[model samples]
Target: MSLRIVPVSFHEACSFVDEWHRHHRAPQGHKFSIGAANEADELVGVAIIGRPVARPLDDRLTLEVTRMATNGTPNACSLLYGAAWRAAKALGYRRLVTYLQAEESGVSLRAVQWKIVAHLPPRRGWSTGCRPRTARGTDNVARTRWEARIAT
Candidate 1:
């Protein structure tokens, strides 16, 4: 299917966030999200980012990309990540962050131009604890982190 990143309005975001929480309820809790829309304008993927309310000691806003998903194809995740990075940059965020699960081995996070900052701690409950009751597949998970600097 055709995939594109679009600006989700406040009301639209609310609905998507609600649906996301229903599916994935990880430990730190869900945060604002940038969404991926298909040809039919249906939300097929989401990249949730944690924008810290208070700036930490680093002075750079730590944007924790709490989640990423696709309707089926893994390619969808890269595009969604690109979209979220662009969005976060435009919003004055200094950096973008995300973690891949422990068992998701086949889940490829390496994109041609994206940077791999570190190997993060394995996420505890992406599929079992917070994933949607209907979600399937769990072997490709792993502890991974991806980051992009938004500003100099």
Candidate 2:
């Protein structure tokens, strides 16, 4: 399978994600989006990179893979992960981070040399009396945080 990296508009990437993602819909926004295309020029996977959702992790030097979805193409996730990091590093980001559902195996991350940085326990939705928000279906599902850092 010849996979090549391609630039994708956020809206186009989100549309592919909506059609293929298992647990979540497309994220609200991204700094950039990358796509993996086969020899036929069909996009098979996408990675949405953006500022970290958690305030503490929103340091200027860090960016997060807000969402990644693929059409089950072999090696597509690993390719996207690697491409995203290279793009982020080229833009002067020191670190790239992402999260996986706890039940998911970190095969793609491991392939790209992303380290397990933290195991995040599930919480009630981010909603608070001070900032009301809708509870998402992922409310009770734990997640694992992973990181790929540029060598200093």
Candidate 3:
């Protein structure tokens, strides 16, 4: 089935991710969100772009794909990834990044020309002794960071 990129609200995207994402819970917030809709106008997937969670990369010009979830729709993810980069560039951002669990084959990202930039080893959960946070089961899982340059 063909898919078209469309605007999505943060709440709407979060709902979809909460129901569909395999490895992640819904994100806390986002700069923007995009959706993929099939010919029937039903949402098949969503991408949430937000400020980088990593402090060093949280500059004004960089954004991250904080969450992307789909109902196993073919090409829906690649469509959202490509659309997110184009939208970011149009809004003057310089780069966009995303992370995938090591177990995932990043075929969708590669389909859109996103390059793997780093292989991050598993780490302790985000919680610190002083700043305790809830465990989301993401700790101790290796991740691959991918990036794409926004066209000038």
Candidate 4:
């Protein structure tokens, strides 16, 4: 089935992610968002791009695919990943990155040419004695960081 990549508002994308994503909830915010629509014009997926959650990677030159969710539509994710990278480059960003839970295969990302850059160890939920916070439910899970450089 043919798919179209279209601009999506942050709110709309967040709503889609919340409804369809399996591993995590919608992100706190995003720099921008994109959607994948089927030939019939139904939204099948969304990608939320934002500043890197890790403070070390939060420099102006980099952006992250904070969340991506789909209604099990084949190729929807691959399309979103490619579109997100292209949009980032056009907007003058040098690098685009995203993290995947350890259990997730990076096939979709690989199909779009993103590389696995690092494997991060698991962390306790973001809550600490000093700064208590409710867990978003993904703490203690290992993650793999993937990245693609914007071609000049």
Error of 1 at 38 (Å): 1.7
Assess each prediction's global lDDT (C-alpha) against the native: 0.59, 0.95, 0.95, 0.94
**Residue 7's C-alpha lDDT in candidate 3?**
89
* Candidates in order: C-alpha RMSD to true structure: 6.7, 0.9, 1.2, 1.4
TM-score of each: 0.61, 0.96, 0.96, 0.95
Where model 3 places Cα greater than 4 Å from the true spot, the runs are none
Model 1 alpha-carbon drift over 4 Å, by segment: 9-23, 26-31, 52-60, 102-108, 121-142, 150-152
Question: What lDDT does model 2 reach?
Answer: 0.95
Q: Residue pairs in steric clash, candidate 4?
A: none
Distance (Å) between predicted and true CA of 27, model 4?
Answer: 1.5
User: Predicted candidate 3: what Cα RMSD to the true structure?
Assistant: 1.2
How far out, in Å, is residue 3 in model 2? 0.7
**Which of 1 and 4 is the better model by lDDT?**
4
Worst 10 residues of 2 by lDDT: 132-141
